[model samples]
Target: MDLSALKQLGMDDREINLYLALFQLGPSSIRDIASHTGINRGTTYESLKQMAARGLISYAPKGKRRVFRAEDPDKLLLLAEEKKSALEGTIDSLKTNIIPGLHHLKPDFSAGNVRFYEGDDGIETVLKDILATVGQQTDKEYCVFSTKSIRHHLYRPFPNYTLQRIRRKIKVRVIAVGDGGEDAEYSERKWLKTDGPVDASYIAIYPPKVAMISMASENYPVATVLEAPEVARSQQVVFDALWGFL
Candidate 1:
């Protein structure tokens, strides 16, 4: 019998064993249940006590001893419902109270902040931060300068990045430095003609912040994120001018 569902409801192995033992033995004493389940008498008594507290088992005093029986199996469904309700409440609190309060504790980035990241995980972090920061803004849009050489490596760490951005209604404008860039929802693309191969680099200007991704030796990915309004505004200006011409 697959009793794994009981474990999901917070029952340990001992509690499950003792609970099942009660159904088979039918109103048995702790000693009898322990003997039948091959569990120690002390452990069996404690487990049964916990099970009874959870409303999975019921006990009745009989002379000097107590006889225990398993409660209706439907109680497991009730327990799962209770857990689901508690989890929903927690998620609500996290969104409304906990998350905003924690954001208040972050250090001010007005003086400018720069961070470096390496490898696939690092690139993913940069992409996630871009979405998070831009998604909260009223405009919900950003600009990108992407080179053909680096475009494929950019989203390797975050394959679902475009899907997530589209879902959040965040828009992006891309200035393709060379050739070859895909069209995506909530995004616009323009090409910049190049005569020769350019370095593998991609830049994102998302107001108040900029992220640059490049390939190191042997195509190893690296990223730099700068949090400075002036720098971002300057890049935005250049991108806008070029976008107008293209």
Candidate 2:
């Protein structure tokens, strides 16, 4: 797991380090946590203070010093739940503040360029938009290049989608680079095991547009939407060549 991702989960550097140390070491003193986490005494004390306030740790006075120990592991789950509740509350507050202003505003009548989206829901919105595009297609024929090994792991909702598309007469062609390829019951799908580089990035080209998904990269999931007529035409050409080779 990425330390940056953990930080995004509301953990400061020293707090994350100390928490991870406690998780690994079971229960230990602040000095022991500092030794394992490589955090300074002052930082450790501050982190412990914050953790205790968050109901993450407990300590008992022992002679001249206090012996700190991590609380139940379930406290992490509780913390996560609390964070989720707080975020929902914040979103509700923002919507309450902004929705009336939004209602008073007029829609943008001017044309715009590309839009950037963030987070998992944003990614899902992009995917649903692409699927809508495919649904709009008259003689739907789409092809995608992907990794079979990991597609289902991340896209568990995909199978039912393609099945529905197939029912709608949309043709699907997926070329996976490993075993257990694209979903069954989808049309024109095939797999090939290769030593060549194959991973989470996948390219999907439809008649009117081409989309490339960067799924495994550390950055946010992104797909570029191109409207250039010539670009789409050229991509279709390249897609035809690859489709034939596959």
Candidate 3:
């Protein structure tokens, strides 16, 4: 019988063995259950005590000995519901009390919060942050400095990024550093003249934060997010200057 569900309910191998042994042996003493499951009598008794506490098993005095039996399998559903309710309560507490209290301890942006991430998942996180942060802004727009080598890889983790941006009505202005780029709704693109291959790099200038993504050794993607309003404003100024020249 596939008792994998029991494992999901936090039953270890010994507990599972003891539970199963009870089902097979009916109301049995710890010695009988231990012998049936090949677990020592002392360990078997302890496991039964724990399972009984969890309402997974029950025991009765059978003359000088305690005889244990597995409770109805439907009891597993009740156990799962209890776990789910507890988890929901924890989530509510975090949203209502814990997270807000923790936010009070965060350092101010003058220190320039910098975070580094590696791999495609990290890049996706950076992209998601751009959308989320910009989505909340009144302007609903951002700027990008994208190069040909890095442009294709940027959206691999979020293929529908442009579509989502358009759906959210978030506009973007892109200054392409090499040959290729495509136009999309709520987006404008301009190219920079280049004589040789540019290093794979992409920069996003959203107010209060700038995300830089680059290709590292072996073409692995890495990203850095700097949360500094002053730095982002400076980059936006420079991008606007170059944008007008191109």
Report, for every candidate in turn, its global Cα lDDT versus the true structure: 0.91, 0.68, 0.91
Between 1 and 2, whose TM-score is larger?
1
Query: Which candidate model has the greater TM-score, 1 or 3?
Result: 1
**Ten-residue region with minimum lDDT total, candidate 2:** 106-115
The candidate scoring highest on TM-score is 1
Each prediction's number of clashing residue pairs: 0, 0, 0
Q: After superposition, how far is residue 90 of candidate 1 from its true place, in Å?
A: 2.0
Worst 10 residues of 1 by lDDT: 103-112
Residue 67 lDDT, candidate 1, scale 0-100: 92
Angstrom error at residue 194, model 1: 3.3
Instruction: Give the true-structure RMSD of model 2.
Output: 12.7
lDDT of 3 by residue, 1-246 (tens): 888778889999889988888889898988889888999888888888999999999999999999899999899999999999999999999988999898667777544499999988999999999999999899999999999999878889899998999999999999999898988999999999799999999999998999999999545899999998899999999999999998
Error of 2 at 138 (Å): 1.9
The residue-by-residue lDDT of candidate 1 on 106-213, one tens digit each, is: 676633388999999999999999999999899999999999999888889899999999999999999999999999899999999999999999999998899999
lDDT of 1 at 201: 93
Runs with alpha carbons beyond 4 Å of true place in candidate 2: 1-113, 153-159, 216-220
Total clashes in model 2, counting residue pairs 3 or more apart in sequence or in different chains: 0
Residue 178 in model 1: lDDT? 94
Model 1 lDDT, full chain set: 0.91
